[model samples]
Target: MRTVLDFTPLYRSSVGFDRMLDLLDNASRVASVDNWPPYDIAKIGDADYRITMAVAGFAQDELTVTQEGNNLLVGGAKTGDDSGEYLHRGIAGRTFQRRFELADHVKVVDANLTNGLLTIDLKREIPEEMKPRQIEIGQASSPAQVSQIDQGQKAA
Candidate 1:
């Protein structure tokens, strides 16, 4: 049985969370999709993440990784064909495409394939203008300085 959740109440109380809510809804809708070429997402540091996917029987040249806005796409396609017949085929080499939605400011840093495992590194880089800054408070001006400003105004 499939369960459905209502987000209307959440929307009524929260503000600036539309993207997160939409992502949750989309994940629920795609929950029944195929799980071919299993993958894992790990957090290495405060702002660093890694995604590893099992891509056995696929060559490095046959795989492609791309990023569009806040979305990351990984795809694989078999290059060579099977000319000989097999008595029992067990290995899977079918083409697949996976989509991952990333948070704001998150970017793809590097990607590598080793031992049939494809690893992708991601990092979140906050811009200088967007980073938190300290504000300096000013104290009241001295009475002498205020008086000098008034006298200068009268002379003018």
Candidate 2:
């Protein structure tokens, strides 16, 4: 016997969360788990993030970074170890797949592998038109309007 978890009910109940529901649906089928390569996700700034994975045994050529739709996929497959002549192969040199959920405007800037660490940078660009702007409040009176206010105050 198997248990099936239905999320459609919850998704329909959620308000102003259609995109999030879509993300959740996509994540449900995304490639994750079992292939758990140790990783760290850090928010570098208000709109910037960094994903660093400890891929020690994997080389730059072995690793691949790509974006499928709105998801970032980091995968690696160690190659050409056909002889299998390792007496003590403690290090993990097998294939791994990692998926990251990205926001609507988030994009992968770049990925680099150095000293066994694979670092992927992401940036969310809020457009000038979308960014919040401050409105300066000044005294609401032109020279003519100020005279009228002064006269009213004096009369009162």
Candidate 3:
């Protein structure tokens, strides 16, 4: 299936959308969709995020979280029970997959499963060069250094 993305017209007016176009191109190449175990992604802090998935029948031991380059891969498989009888099995009980793309320097801090909620925490580490710095101002020693006095002298 081909998606008609007429970004050329949009790209002309939106200079900020250049990166978005690259992301959309990457998304077009991903030809798989495995929407097992509905999940949610939330921004917890300025540079932190969390991904929560509703894995009701899955235990912590059954799930796995892995990081491959710039993407986070989450998957799980339930061990079959030989003794348990399934008279009416409606829920899905197979391996599930979920992928999330991370920005540069973003990493998974930890993953925890609590009360059927699997939460994956991610934090983006800002580079020391990228952090904001305070620039100190010096007191003017000469009257000419003051911009108001300079303008007054020019008027005179």
Kindly list the per-residue Cα lDDT of model 2 for residues 62-106, writing each as its tens digit. 999999777899999988566868788778778988878788789
- The lDDT values for all models are 0.94, 0.85, 0.86
For candidate 3, write residues 1-156 as lDDT tens digits: 678566678777887678778888778877777677889999999989999999988878899999998889999898867487889987777788788888878999999999989999999998999889998999757765687778888999
Better of 1 and 2 by TM-score: 1
For model 3, the stretches where C-alpha displacement exceeds 4 angstroms are 6-20, 29-32, 132-156
The C-alpha TM-scores of every prediction are 0.84, 0.68, 0.69
Per-residue lDDT over 98-132 for candidate 1, one digit per residue giving the tens place of the 0 to 100 score: 99999999999999999999999999999999999
Best by lDDT: 1
* Model 2: pairs clashing at backbone N, Cα or C within 3 Å: none
Q: Give the poorly placed runs of model 1, Cα more than 4 Å off.
A: 139-156
Of candidates 2 and 1, the better by lDDT: 1
Q: What TM-score does candidate 3 reach?
A: 0.69
Candidate 1 least-lDDT 10 residues: 25-34
